[model samples]
Target: MNRRKQKKLTNRLVWAAAVGDTCTVRTVLRTGVDPELPEADGTTALYAASVHGAASTVRALLRAGALPNTESRGITDGTPLCGAAAWGHVATVRELLTHGADPNLREDGGAGSTPLFWARNGASGPHPETEAALVAAGATD
Candidate 1:
């Protein structure tokens, strides 16, 4: 693929994950598109799926070799676990944890917050299941 086509495909892949389009995600990957391509914001499709609570898509992406702990540096610079926890997606958090995402890995900037911090203080407030999962995974406050 040319650069423009590659970029567009990457955008589509990211969008598919963000919108919870698991079938489209599979189609895009089946067409030889890599699941780990980073968007402009440094987010992989896996990160987007995790953030949006797309649990099945998260599993599919991970099965396709998406790195569970890939971090990005944007306004929200954190790993997939951070995004999932921030949104109170307990199932997604479990999926990511099962795939080896590190709940204790802190965000890159600001207070160096971990997924535990986001689970406790994100816009959704503290989610008990998410918090429990993080705690079970050895996350710190």
Candidate 2:
């Protein structure tokens, strides 16, 4: 496939995971698609799954060798860990951490904030499960 087609496939996989379509994701992966491929915004399938609280998809991507610390698009310079924490996806956070995601990994520039910070500062729901997950993953703050 050409570069453009490959990129389109990668974006589709990311979108599928983000939307919780695990079957479509698996089908794409089985078709020799690259799991680590990032979207135009630099968001990977793992990152999308993390933000969407798709634990199964996240696990599958990890098993396929997706990088937990993969950076996202724009000036945010965020990682999948940050996305999981920001979205309060506790199970996803746990899965990412178990797969070797660094809770202390901060974004570039002056963000300098860890996944724990994001979990603590960004969470707004009733459960706070993301923060709990970050703590379980060894987050200090």
Candidate 3:
């Protein structure tokens, strides 16, 4: 694929992931675009999908080999697991954990918040379900 076409598909993949548009996401993936492709600031499709609680999109990206634990910057800043936990997306958290997200991985920037920490101290409020999912996945402190 040409650089121009590849860039367009990558943008589409990121947008689709962010909006939970699993159908579009799958189509982009089929075009041989690496699901791990990051946007200008380093947000991968999986990170975008996870931050938006797009569990189905997350699954599609992961199935295409998106790394569950990659640290990202840009619209959001952290691992996909941290993004999901911080938002209290229980199903998204579970999907990431099931796909090998390290429950203990810490955010690179910020105060090194782990998924459990984010779940317990989310700005939206404490997320017991999210916390529970992290704990069940072996998260600590």
Candidate 4:
């Protein structure tokens, strides 16, 4: 895999995950692209999938060895769990937690908010289900 080819595959994987294209994600994974590969600004495929609430894509990435706690920088600044929680995506949050996302992990790009903080103050409104899931996963304020 040359650097250019690897970058192209990684871009495809990231775009596929962002759009919830689970099939594409799996196909790219099979091609041996690193599941943890980040985009130019440091957004991993798992983080992109999680932010979109793409649970199926999230699962595919996780199964392909994406780290659930990996953080995104620049535009989408946070861990995958933080991104999911901030968007009030309970299923995504659960998927991340189940795959070893540290519920207590903080987003360095913000005020270092945890997943719990995002769930409570989420722009989508306070998501009780998301909050509950985070709490169950041992997330603290």
Against the true structure, whose TM-score is highest? 4
Q: Report the error of model 3 at residue 15, Å.
A: 0.4
Error of 2 at 91 (Å): 0.7
CA lDDT for candidate 3? 0.89
Model 4 spans with C-alpha error above 4 angstroms? 109-111
Q: lDDT at 137 for candidate 4? A: 82
Candidate 4 weakest ten by summed lDDT: 105-114
Candidate 4 lDDT at 100 equals: 92
lDDT of 4 at 72: 80
Per-residue lDDT for 1-141 in model 4, tens only? 899999999989999999999999999999999999898778899989988999999998998899887788877778899889888989999988888999998889545998999899986878899999999889887
Estimate, for each residue in 46-137, the C-alpha lDDT of model 1 and write its tens digit. 88898999999999999988889887666446788889999999999999999998878887754578899889887678888899989998
Error of 2 at 86 (Å): 1.3
Give candidate 4's root-mean-square deviation (CA, Å): 1.4
If scored against the real structure, what TM-score would every candidate get?
A: 0.92, 0.86, 0.94, 0.95
Q: Candidate 4: which pairs clash? A: none
